[model samples]
Target: MTTMARDPKGYYAVLGLDPEADAEAIRAAYRQRVKVVHPDRDPSTRAREEFRRLMEAYAVLKDVIRRAEYDGVAPAEAGGESDFTPMPVACGTCGSLTAQPRYVVFRTVRSYLIWAKLGRLDGIFCRDCADHAAARASIVSWLWGWWSLPGLILTPFALLANLFGGSKPRRENTRILLRQARAFLGRGDLVLARSLAEQAATFARGPDDRARVAALLRATDGAVSGHHRRLKSRWRPGGRVFLAQALPLLALPVTIAIFVLIAIRPWDQPVSTVAPIAVHPATVGEIRHVAVDGLKLRMAPLPGAPVLTLLDRFTTVEVNAATASPDWVGVRTPAGIEGYVETRALYAGSGSRFKTEWCSDNRGAPPTAGEILSRRVSGDHRLLVHNDGRRDGVVKLKTLAGSTVLSVYVPATFHIGVGGIPDGTYRIEYATGTRYSRGCALFIDEMQASVLPMTVTFHYQSPTATRSLTNIAEVWLSPQSGTVPRPLPLPPDRFAADD
Candidate 1:
C-alpha cells in the first residue's frame, strides 16, 4: 500500500465511525449488524450491500499486521468507492464467482425549531443499504423517547401548513397531529397535548372520525383544552371574532417566548480554584516563557508529542527522553503537543514534568449542561465562547448569563466554538456568508451531554425530528447511558481492527 493510503480517515468515515474508534466498539457494531443483515439470513438487495461494508470494515480492522502497517499512514483516503472494489472469490470446488455487492447504508439526523415544540427532529433515512426493518425499529424507539409526546411533532407540521397558506391539507395534517397527540397524551404533556387533541377533534373530516379522536383525547388527557360549554357559547355569541383577533396576538407572544427560551442558556456551577501542578521536571534548564491565559497547555518539544502545561513563566522541564519528531520531547507538556515547539518556549527553572493528559473528568472532550452565557465573533469568523467550566457543561445560549461568547459560521472555512460548551437549550445565529446577511435558523437542545467530543452529520432534507439543524454544540448524546463513546471505530477492547 502507498504511504498516503494508510491514513484511516476515509475508512472510519465510511463505517460512520470516528478515526479513534476502539476495538470492542467495532465488534459490537458489527455484531448488531450481522444479526440482522448477515448473508446467512437476509436476502434483500439492501441487506447485501450492508453485508459487504460490514465484511470490508472487519477485514481491514481485524488484521493486526495490516492495521499497524496501515495506521502508519492516513486512513481517511479509504472508501467503498470503485478504487477499492471487492472481487468475489470462487469456492474451492465450484470455482464460481460469488457476486458481492458494494457500498453500505446509514441514516442522517436533522433538527429545527418551530412555534413552541422543543428539541424537535425529523430524521431522513439514507437511501443506501440498510433494510426498512432497521429503519422502522429506530423510528418506533424515537416515538417513545426523543419525541415530546406527539404534540411537538404534530403541531409543528399542522401549524406550519396553516401558516403557509395551505388549509386544505389541514385535515390530513390533523391526523398526523392526532396520532402524535395521542402519543404525547400517553406520555403526559396534558396542557399542550390536550390542545392538540382538541384541535385534531375540530379538524376530523367526518362525525365518526371526530368522535373517535375526541373520545381518545378525553380518555388520555382528561377533556380538551377548551370546555364544551365555553366553545358552544363562544360560537353562539361571537367566538369566531374573538379568537380571530385575540388568539393570534396571544399566540404570537407564546410563540416568541418559546423561541426566546430555546435561545436562553440554562444554569451550571463553576470550577473554583487555581490550576494544580500535574507534572514534574527532571533536567534543570533556563527555558524562557511566552504568554499565559485560561488555557492549560502552551509549549511542546515537537509537533505531535506530549505537551507540558505552562503554569507560569518560571516553570522548567527536565528532558528525560527524546523523540524522532520535533513536536514532542520526553519532558512532556499538558495533553501532548510535543512536535512543533522548542524547549525555550517553556519555563525550565525546575518545577515539575508536564502531565500526560491534562483533561479533567468534566473537561477535555467531556460535555456538561450549562446555558450559553455569551457569544462573540473573531476577526476571521471564529467563535470565542466563555462557558461555565465548573458544573454541568451545558451552556444555554439564550439567557446570555454565566457563560458567554460569540460564534461565526463561515461557509468556506470551518468555524468552531472556542473553549467549552455547556448543554441545554440555545438560540444560535448561523452565519450567512455575507457581512450583511441575516441569521437563517434557530437551534435548541442543540447539544447532548457527554464527556467525549463527537462528530455530527446533518443534511438539508426532511430530517426525522432530530437534532441535526439545532444543537451543534456538544455533539452525540446516545440513546441511553453506557452507550459506547462515539467516534470510536472499534469497541474499547482490542482497539480497532487493523485499518
Candidate 2:
C-alpha cells in the first residue's frame, strides 16, 4: 500500500474530501485514501497518521447532516468543491440560476508548440444571456474585423468562435429578436420594427438566420417608406426639406448673370497696319552664293527640266527677267549659259517694294537695302524675326554677292546667326505663300559684331499669291571669330500679331 500525506486542517482535508462532498463521494474517497495509506502495509509513523486521518474524514463526510454542519462552520472550505458542484450558478448579468460556469479552451500556435492549454471560464449562461453575449461579440467582430489587412483574415475565425464555440445563446436570441421585429411590423410601428430587425441581424449566428433577418428588415423598410411618404405629403413649403430643394433653382439666375457680365466686357484692341508683300522689280545682279549647296541650274523653271549646269556658292550670274512664279528667276551665267535659278539663290539690287497705302509706320522712309548692306561689311550679326498675327513666312539670308548663307522657316518668331557669312554684307528677305486679309508684321534685329545694333520693322500682307522680298543686313566678323551676338529689340510698328 502507498502512504499519503496527512491534511492539517480537518478530517475532510485529510481524505481530500470537500466539505460539501455527499455520502457516495465520501465513501469513494475513503476507499482510495485507505489503499494509499494503509497502516498494515506501511509500517511508519507518517503512514499511521495518514490512515487515521482518512478514517476520521470518512466518518464525518459520509453523513449528509454532518457534512452540512462542517460546511456552515468553515465556509471557505466550500470554494474547493465549487468546480465539482452539480448545482447551477446565478448569471452575472441576468441574476438567474440558469447560468453554469464553463471553460472555453483555445489551441493557438503558441499553445500547440508549448503543449499548453489556454482557456477562459465563461458563464454557462441560460439560453438568453449566452445568446446575447455571443451576438454582441459577433457584432463587434464583424464591425471591426475588416478595419485592417490582417483583420480581414482573422475576422471569420473570431466571428465563428463568438457565434458557436462556447454557447448556443446567440442563435436563440436572434430568433427572439426577429420575432419581436415581426410583431412590431404587424402593429405598424415601422421605426421600432426596423430597429429590432437590425439588432436581430447583428446577433444572427448563421447564414440562414441572417437571411431570415434580412427579409424582415426588407419588410420593415417598406413600412418605413410608407411612413416617409405620409410625412412628405403633409410637409409645408416653408419646411426645411422644401427650402433645400428650392435653393439650387434660386441660385441659377445669379450664376447666369455673372457669366453674362464676363462675356460682354469691352476689350481695347489695337488696329493692324501691315502692307501687302510685292515682288522686287527685276534688276541685273550676280549670284554671290547658293543658299543650298550643289544647286543645279536647269534649262526650264520646272524641277524635272534638264539640268544645264551645277552651280556653287558665289557663282556670277545676270538676271534677265522675273518669272510669273516668284520661286524661279530667269538668269544667264557669266559663261553665257542661260538657265533658270531659284530667286532665293541670288542677291540682287531690286529691293522690296511695299504698297504705301498700308504703311503703318511711315515715320521715315523704310531703310534701303544698300543702307543695310553697308553696315554688315565688317562683323558678326544676329538676326531676329518676329512674325506678328496669324501670318507665317520663310526668311532667307544671302551675301550681297549672291551667296545664300541661311534660310529659316518662320511660323511665328525666328532667330538666325549671320556670323558664318565671312564678315560681309547680306540681304534679308521674307515671303509667304498664303494670302491674309489683315496682314502680318515682321521685326528684324541686326546685331553686328563691334558695331551698333540696327532694328528694322516691316508690315507685310499677301493679298493674292505667294510673294518674296529681300533687304540688307550687315555682319562684320572675321571667319575665325567665334563670338555670339544677341538679338536687339523690335522697332515699334502698328500691327498687332499673335506671338
lDDT of 2 by residue, 1-499 (tens): 0111112247666767654454566688788888888977898999998888777667756643334233333233443644221212233345454212222221111122224222222433444554555555545554554555556555555544543444334665465456556555666767766776666665787999989888877877765665443211111123443343245335646877878776753221111212363334445453333333467899888879899987653345678766788778788876798888876655433212122122223223333211222222333334545544243444445444444455444443323333323344445444433322122223332211111233232333346734433343433222224645433323222111111
**Candidate 1, residues 353-404: lDDT per residue as tens digits?**
1211111111222222222323442222222333322212221222223222
Candidate 2 structure, TM-score to reference: 0.19
Each prediction's RMSD over C-alphas, in Å, is 37.1, 27.2
Top-TM-score candidate index = 2
| Residue 477, candidate 2: C-alpha displacement in angstroms | 40
TM-score of each: 0.16, 0.19
**lDDT computed for candidate 2:** 0.47
Among all candidates shown, the one with the greatest lDDT? 2
Kindly give the stretch of ten consecutive residues in candidate 2 with the minimal lDDT sum: 101-110
